[model samples]
Target: MAQLSTEVYWHSTEPTEVGPPLDGDASCDVCIVGAGYTGLWAAHFLKQAEPGMSVRVVEAKFAGEGASGMNAGFVQMTAGKVLRRMLWYYGAEKAGGVYRAVARSILEIGRFCRQNGIDAQYENTGILQVATDTKQLARLELQIKRAQRAGVTSFRLLDREQAQERIGSPTVLGALKVSGALLNPYRLVRGLARVVQEQGVLLHEQTPAQTIEKVDGKWRITTPHGTITANEVIVATEAMQGAFPELYARQMPVWNYLLVTEPLTDEQLGRVPWPGREGVANSLSFSTAARLTADNRVLWAGGLWYMFGNRDTDPRHRRNDDAFDKLGASFREFFPQWRDVRFSHGNGGLISWSHSFIPQFGRTDSGMVYGHGYTGSGIAASHTGGKILRDLVLRRKTEFTELAFVTVNQPKFLPAPFGDKGGEFFIWRQRVGDRLPLLLPYKSALAPNRFFARRTGSPERATAGRSSD
Candidate 1:
């Protein structure tokens, strides 16, 4: 199949446009360059933490127009990280601390919405990570143990039978259920913009940064219509950091796409069961992620994802459509019963990738406090990143420096140009354990992409997807 090519997702149908462009020189204590959750939240919390500080946001397109708006909307609690990685990255205890920071972000989001009077269809129904085979089940077991040690209160292990009953899918051999929330990412972004505006933060949309420089010992971020002179500049544009090359080298881009089925009839809905409205991902991790929306549609995504905003750059958006179709067809083979269901929308967007495939945060040599490279797992991490960046500028301690960035000796990401063949091959090796049952057991270093086999029917449950925050 042609590899998936965009990250714009479920809420792609939601309307959007560049906010009014910058008109002239703007001065602020802190200037955020992207309006996605990270930038907006930075503005909001900064105002909360220090109300007098001037804050401004500038976006190439509208808020949520990037990964934040184009994801499966799964708010990953720290409860979702692989146990071994935590052990390796932070040596168990510290890893748990990182996880705690992520877990707390869920509550932070709710508080942000309620306090701001922005209703983004936030539902605290939790999430499910299912393993479709013995190997995957074993991986789930490690995750369960790790979560327990990390002090996570809401993670539970489900065996094959119990998992099947809980998810209404017999293909699942194991699952990890934990506390999380579902959201209309589009609504969430809109709500954030509204709140940030109310808090007195200026927003500049459709204003791409032509150049960023430091003049007279201050940071100057310039666009076509205006410039932002601030004590500090926050580069929250996770994937599209085209304005800075240092960022591009540290954070790479990959393609992922999502499609939603027409609202499932009460009849079809009955056949598929979930506990309230939980988000879902697969245990194998070939980058598939899915979620239940505020509406009844099931939104799903996978593969080489990219985003060309406004769907204006190219019609057919052929690459993403094929990825969506692959996911749809895979879903059909797993549950032939849903084949006739109509699809109301098909869309794609971008997910940021760090050199280490880990989300990163902190300052740069250019005096630009940077926070990009989510590598598709931004949801809760984004919130934490914002807080960390805020602290960095304010001269406070942050865990950002401690988190391990995806680097050399780690799985060398496939070189560009090989495309799908290389991607699928890499995926297959990492995931073989999941698809092959007990053959290889599990390893934090064990890649899960090799296991992308069999319909398993349920794609999202096997791997958590990316987000804009």
Candidate 2:
């Protein structure tokens, strides 16, 4: 067995190119902080909308160095339970709109990859939300009903035998095959940065925005390399948003980990025989997902881990031995045929989780535009987010800006030690709930929906307006 390497495997898929940092004070039409998927996509759409407009993106490190390169490469539509949470907080119309928008983004990403000639290893193999037990199967059925009610027609149910035919997981009781795709996120993000740069967008690597403020009716961003002033500023930092005091309360960073097996031999591959190679994710809040790499390795990830500090993104948090152990056990249980297989890599990344369990998009109180908090799923949503941010920045009243997630009054996590404690407790309770069948009745209590609903009265009351204002 090979010793598991901590490096993110996707970054090794291709050569990384880093642009020069900002030289001195500069000005632009728009300045976007954090050059990950959200920031890069926003810049792409902004330039697409107004080709002549000057846009500059400032990154603390290289573009895609953050979650963009480290994520599980799932271009999924139903991220962070947005479908169910949107339906619970907003009406079916708004929820359906959000779903449809993301679904379109997934397809568009594939098209964008093909058109741009980026060999991100894009595959249109849809994902499978599998259930391992009766309880999880019931949850899948409920989600199917909710999806139907929301006018989503892409979900197709597969029985145990049918699901096993695709995944060969003995533990899979059933699954919901949904429209999605998978790709090398590092390649996609780097490709996005390159494409945006080609379109005359200045990408300044190693330029961290230290402070942002309003001056003379314009936004001024102070960075390590130089200061950048722009007519508009976009805070697209995502999980790293907590680093900024101005945006800390809006989101929190939770560390999640995964492991990847060494490339399987022809005999090992024959044992599984996954022809479609669809992404497989379980129906748990702290769920696990597995996918096949283009190199024939099995990447298994998912199992949420939150540190005491909501903003913690230290390099040390990238490796959680206990989580990796749990993942290995779960993988063995799922695919007993591959019980002896060894993981060659095991690493983790932080995801920006919103208090509402849905993404937050719109302008902030300080008059700057922002979008983040995709929970764990963001590859496809970030593409849609870019278009939404474009509309918001351009002051367009398009359907993208009218979605429920584009509101100003998004719910916030509790402040300080309390919020940290609450998060720890939530994880503990969920882990306990997964084990004890007796705790099934109190499972809904784990979500903040009931509390928010009672306080706000109705969906309309909770989310007041369609406009960002």
Tens digits of lDDT, candidate 2, 345-446: 999898898887788898877788999999888998899999999999999999889877795358887888888887788789878766655335432233
Candidate 1 regions exceeding 4 Å error are 1-18, 78-83, 148-154, 303-319, 398-437, 441-469
Q: Look at candidate 2 and tell me the lDDT of residue 140.
A: 62
**Residues 1-469, model 1: lDDT tens digits:** 2333233444454555557999898888988888898898788778877888888888887888777876777777433444465566546566666666777887688777888776777887777777665555556656656665655534354545556666766566656667678777777888888888888888888887777788998889889998889888888887667447556455555556666766787888888666555666776556455666766877766633443332123324434555666778756654466778766566655656553455667666676777776666677778887777777777765464455431112332333344334544545666563355465546422433332322133434333322101
Candidate 1 residue-wise lDDT at 257: 64
Per-candidate local distance difference test? 0.65, 0.82
Clashes of each: 42, 0
Predicted structure 2, TM vs. truth: 0.91
Clashing pairs in 2: none
